[model samples]
Target: MKRILVPTDFSEHAEDALKAAAQIAKKNGAEIFLLHLLELPNQMNDAVTNGSSIPEVMLFIKKANEKLQKIKEQPHLQGITISTTVQFEKAFDGILSFNKKNKIDLIVMGSHGSSGIEEILIGSNTEKVVRLSDIPVLVIKKDLDTFNIKNIVFASDFSKEIKKPFLKMIEFAKIFDANLILVMICTPNSFKTTSMGEKTMKNFIADFEVNNYSMHIYNDSNIEKGILNFTNMVGADLIGLCTHGRTGLSHFFNGSISEDLVNHTIKPVITFKI
Candidate 1:
């Protein structure tokens, strides 16, 4: 990774993500862009709409810059190259615009779980970025000091759609020198025989020339639960997923499986669009 973009709201969860990004930057010698979005209040928003005085908008950005300056003084960011910027936009829009203009190699952001109904109305900032980002996104839920990725559980259907993201996942796994385990989740509604499951897995691996990776079939009530159960069983350090699976729109109506995993799991998740 060359550059990491971390969007922060100055929340504890966002701070955790900043700390984790610092560690990664130290390891890879990458620069960190610590971004804070200055969302205006309704009155200021209406002022801008009516071409009123720019004092309110300017003041908000000034405060945001002051906040970032305090964060920049933290001891943990001493050795790493860091830059701070404040944008006058919503969190998601600011992140997307910055990523596009700056060419972010990866985005590391934090999520404080949201319910399905809540997500359908207004998705969490992290979830929105994951859905829209073209590059890989790493969602952090806990305060992790050392990101020692040992075993990565990549749960997918072994479909052609997974091939692209699988390549990116492989590169990420190699960064940590971790074992990449491929797992297929078989639910009651979509059960697959052992032979068929194994056959599909073999074909998937064969097409990619994947070696030195483990494969398995997990049976559970649903894909999300199956992935979590298997990860716990094997003590995997990370979870890899591809956004927008076979079902597409209908599947991600409230939130995609990848989004749900990010919302619920404490384990770090890496996702790429299908």
Candidate 2:
């Protein structure tokens, strides 16, 4: 974890993310890149390009900069290497672009938990980022005075594709020296016998030679519910999972458990793209 990208909308939720990022950065001795996007209208962008000097656009930029500076000066962020960028682009696009250009190791951002009609319409920038980001993304929902992870619930199918992200999850767990509860969710739709589940999980763990971990087969109606139920039952501090980074119609029809967890769960989630 060398570089962390935190995109903010100047909301309380965004501050929660910043505080979490600060803790992680301090732990890893990593730099924090704080980004705020200004989704300016086409006319405003043209005016700025032509040096027309739109007062409102300039004012927005100035205020965003001021806010960013204030956040950097916050007590929690002190002594951390913080870089701020106020960009003229959509939130999701700017975040991905920044990550690629900077080679960010992780993205720690906050979600405001959308649901029902609102989610159907506007969706969430945090969800989009989690769905698309190549690097690991940690989604924080609230303020964590001390971002400690003693137990991590990692839910997966124990499939071959999960190996890549599963390794990334291990690296994250090592940072906290956390105990990993590797779970395979067995819903009725995708039911597997206990013996089969245990054998598969054992095989998966064997490849990595992981330590300080336990395996379990959880049963629920759906994957999201199963993972959440298992995590809550075990009182896990963090939830780690892999996402296929699905989009468009595929994402709509099939949906994503990782993205759903990002939107619905209050627990801090770290998603790795598989």
Candidate number with greatest TM-score: 2
**Candidate 2 residue-wise lDDT at 153:** 93
User: Global lDDT of each model?
Assistant: 0.78, 0.81
Q: Model 1: per-residue lDDT, tens digit, 118-137?
A: 35214566657776787888
Each prediction's number of clashing residue pairs: 0, 0
Please, what are the lDDT tens digits per residue for candidate 2 over residues 1-274?
8899999999887888888888888888899999999999888988988988788998999999999999999988899999999998888899999999999999998766434312421456766777778899997766778899999998888888888888888888888889999898888878889999999888888999677999998899887778878888999999887778775101211345534544456788888887
Model 1, global lDDT: 0.78
Q: Give the worst 10-residue stretch by lDDT in candidate 1.
A: 245-254
RMSD of 2: 2.9
Model 1: residues with Cα > 4 Å off, grouped in runs: 42-55, 113-122, 209-212, 245-264
Q: Lowest summed lDDT over 10 consecutive residues: which window, candidate 2?
A: 247-256
